[model samples]
Target chain A: MDKNINVLIVDDYRTMLRIIRNLLKQLDFNNVDEATDGQEALAKLRAGNFGLVISDWNMAPMTGLDLLKEVRADARLKNLPFIMITAESKTENVVAAKQAGVSNYIVKPFNAETLKEKIEKVMVHA
Target chain B: MPDGAQAGPDEDRIEAAVRAVLVSMSGDLTAKEAALLAELEALGRTIARAKAEIAQLSVDDITGAHIPSATDELDAIVDHTAQATNEILDACETLEKLEAEVPPAAAEALQGAVTRIYEACSFQDITGQRISKVVSALKAIESRVEAAVANASGRPAPAPAAAAPVAPKTEGQELANGPQLPGGGTSQEEIDRLLASFD
Candidate 1:
């Protein structure tokens, strides 16, 4: 995995964002940015050069699924690696995210090892 | 009244009797119609009054009082847990920085302990999501009450209070309910298996 790639983490919860950032730091990924919701995330994704997107599913105004759909629809961002981290463990959620073209999915309350593993899986093909 | 008609005392008496009966029947019909209309108006008023009472109860007793308080308390829980989790993370970071100064065996133990603490802090996220689900449920109830009131009263749903919580953005959001309670939902391994099938 490229530890130097610019990663954007989108979550409405500040604590979750901080936790993910720290976990990424532990995995040796120093470049990380954050957006609180999908709208802000989309703006950041469009304005900046982001290699990967790590987003939570539920948010106000716009959701991670909404973000994924937007990314997939955009010509420039369609191929960008995306991972969804959410507390929703339903089968439909996973299928919907997969249909939206997410690269990987992680259930919440995950450890650094799980985060590393998912990142490696997605970035290897990126 | 016809061109050829017998003019007799009996014929004139029968005509007068028929006129009297017809007039009485017409009067009865008009009175009955008026009574029915009045009853319908009263029924409408009663329904409107009932709907107004229900709306008041929903807004004043439930949404205005209990629901907001409950949601606020849940929000506070998330806030407090987050604060505590950050403090724990801070301690762990401090321990990490001090690892070099500690003896090697103790340093190894400390590292393992810190890693566990980091993992344990994730409870805050899970609990926070669960509380959010509850808040969402409460909001749904408030919406239903408003809808019922509007339908009964033949008026538009009243706008929620300025301080009232906002609804989720989409149907998918409600479907994407956060983590399930114990004994429910797919396990992580099962989820992974399901994802593998998609491949």
Candidate 2:
């Protein structure tokens, strides 16, 4: 059996985290870990190896943007793929995420197909 | 005059005058009463319609889509109605105050107008209150959705692994402070400059 890919899902909402984890599992990424906010996620990142990061934009204490910035700043995790999920569909927000070096941006109310496509795109470039 | 004798023209003229006065008085009273009844009935219908509309509206509609515009329209309508109602009430009060000064015919006409104004104003007030409640409900729904979204996602999601090991802290140092900044006793100005550099 192929070893499962390690995916870290960061979001403030438990439901969204479960949903993302389920989606990743369907995509054959069975090794998924979750964090409640960016700060905790960063701590976990420092502790373990993760192949990809899926994060929500709006969160308390440390936002997804802050997490992305931190990840990009770290030499070890700089090359790791990152995907941002958010409710805000505005062009400016998308541009900002892209400029911050996000692999892809997914808007909220998305289906499994779209999530899969985004993941594929990020993995291909990575 | 004998008990069975026919009434003379003078007596008939006196009777006609009395009948005319009574008919005019009765007509005025009936018109006033009817106007009041009509106004009350209209007010009741308006309230009922407003209530029905309020019942049909979903909370999501108020908060999720075009909320500000909907609220603004509702506020405007309510304000217009309130102003109209106040004007009508003021007019009614004015009429009452001038009851002795104005001729009965003119006063009765003014009263009818005031009644109509009151009916219109009451309609607006009922509708406005219902819409305001709807707006409040919508706001509540919005907050709930936000909360649900927050709760569904794990508060702190995991991050990608860092490449290097953090330096070990001294026994007396706080573990929570991840890494010590170089030059232990940094000045406040230097700290501010460092923070500003991040921005």
Candidate 3:
């Protein structure tokens, strides 16, 4: 619920990035940044003082799940709150994301309230 | 196919029979086809298994190979843009409301921000055209795949699922819509229950 906490939003689709950024603004999240994919997201996360990562599940070069795995593997980023955004809520996908240590997940086309709730859940034990 | 829908099965059968006979008597055969008709019938039977496997695949799968699920992605893109258009409009309204409450300078800034947000909605035209392009590409593949299917099945290929007369899409279709509107995907409760069951 800390509006000041820096968030890194990553998606290959510009529209999705804009949509999520706008949604985050509605949620009163001012400290937000974006990247086009996991590779760039990882680089930004490494360079910045981000407290959370909200990423789309699919992308080229590297996927959000790959970013989650890499984040979990990196000693410095292992505990950062990661909220995965998936285009499908398949059982296997949920299990895979959960197993990879995602803090929470939001199905795409989410609204501000959903973002708020998911961020709250992740923040509780982030 | 729409033009030839009235063509009877007998006509098709006779034509196919003639074509099969001609192909059978052809002097030139590919190395693989020649091997299939070797001294024993086992080779032909062995090749039949592979052909059967391919034949069993759904028409969509055959056509899908040429385009990697672009149809679905394009559909999603179209749907997302429509929804995002409304979402952005709502955002603009919200910013406009905020403008009234803020200081004059901040209000002007808010108005400017709203302009930028509205401009971003221009993604609609480009995205719509992109979706159209995807549809066109899919249509081309559909034509080719249908011909292949016709050759394989020895009948006119039926119209693709997309081109089929519009009907009430099934709940199965709704479920298949990946991360669509709210409640389109598996609920968080399901994931939680799954995790709890594991414990």
Candidate 4:
């Protein structure tokens, strides 16, 4: 696995972005960019060829679910690995994300190891 | 046989009975209406009080409740604290990277300080999650208040149920719920099992 793979982290909280960035850094992933919401993430995704997307499920104007659906619709980004991190740990949410072609799901309050493991699980298998 | 006199009294009796029945019916209707108005007034007052609390959570220039923007403030506090913590950790990481160049005693002390800072930063995550709980509660209250106001006013509140988070108004996720407090929400293992069950 290339630890330097470019990963896009989308979240409304700047703190969460920083935390994810720092944790990625710990795991030797230094190449990361960010978006504050799904709309911004879409703009970024179209502009760059991201190896993976780590996004929050809930956001304004556009949501991670919206982003996932859009990504799946786009020919260029349809195959991109997407992981959703959210406090919405319900079965329906998981099912919805899966139906939208999400690669993985991480519940909130997760540690770096959990995140890393989830990411690697998808990245390796995908 | 005094038919004229007898008919007059019978007519009067019938007229009086009809009047009495109408008056009683009117009184009953008025009482019901008054009770309904009182209940509505009480509900309206309760909703107004809740609206005030929602305003305290976050309000616009007009003092109208804007729960999302209001909770955003609490979320921002957590964000800022976490960002500062990240900066501290960045410094710690830098120091650790240069640990070989520093004296053993100095390195140990610096490492200890970094450890403490890192641990302290963990508080930011918990704090942010806790704030999420407060926001969720506010949203629930906001929704109920909105529903009451809408019911009373005969107008739909702007996505009243949207006070709960994670999903939007249109086609809200049937199962998605808001952030959980400590000891709340589904565990990762449960999520994993649920996801696997689909397979």
The lDDT for every candidate, in the order shown, is 0.79, 0.60, 0.69, 0.71
lDDT of 4 by residue, B63-167 (tens): 254666688788788768777776876787787687668999987686566544544555565566567778778778666655544443445556633355554
Ranking by TM-score: 1, 4, 3, 2
TM-score: which candidate is best? Answer: 1
lDDT of 1 at B157: 70
* lDDT of each residue in B65-92, candidate 1, tens digit only: 8888988999999899999988988887
> Residue A87 lDDT in model 4?
74
Return the lDDT, model 2, position A49. 92
Tell me the tens digit of each residue's lDDT in model 4 across A1-126: 887778999987676777677677667788999999999999999999789999988776777888899999999999898999887766678888888888888987676667878988888976
Record all residue pairs in model 3 with backbone atoms less than 3 Å apart, i.e. clashing: A87-B179
Give the chain A TM-score for each candidate.
0.98, 0.95, 0.95, 0.97
Q: Point out the worst 10-residue segment of candidate 2 chain B by lDDT.
A: B171-180
Q: Return whichever of 1 and 2 wins on lDDT.
A: 1
Interface RMSD values for the candidates, listed in order?
A: 1.6, 22.4, 8.3, 3.7
Docking class of 4: acceptable
Docking class of 2: incorrect
Clashing pairs in 4: none
Q: Kindly give the stretch of ten consecutive residues in candidate 4 chain B with the minimal lDDT sum.
A: B1-10
Q: Cα lDDT for residue A34, model 3? A: 94
- Pitting candidate 1 against candidate 3, the one with the higher lDDT is 1
Error of 1 at A5 (Å): 1.4
Of the candidates shown, which would achieve the greatest lDDT relative to the real structure? 1
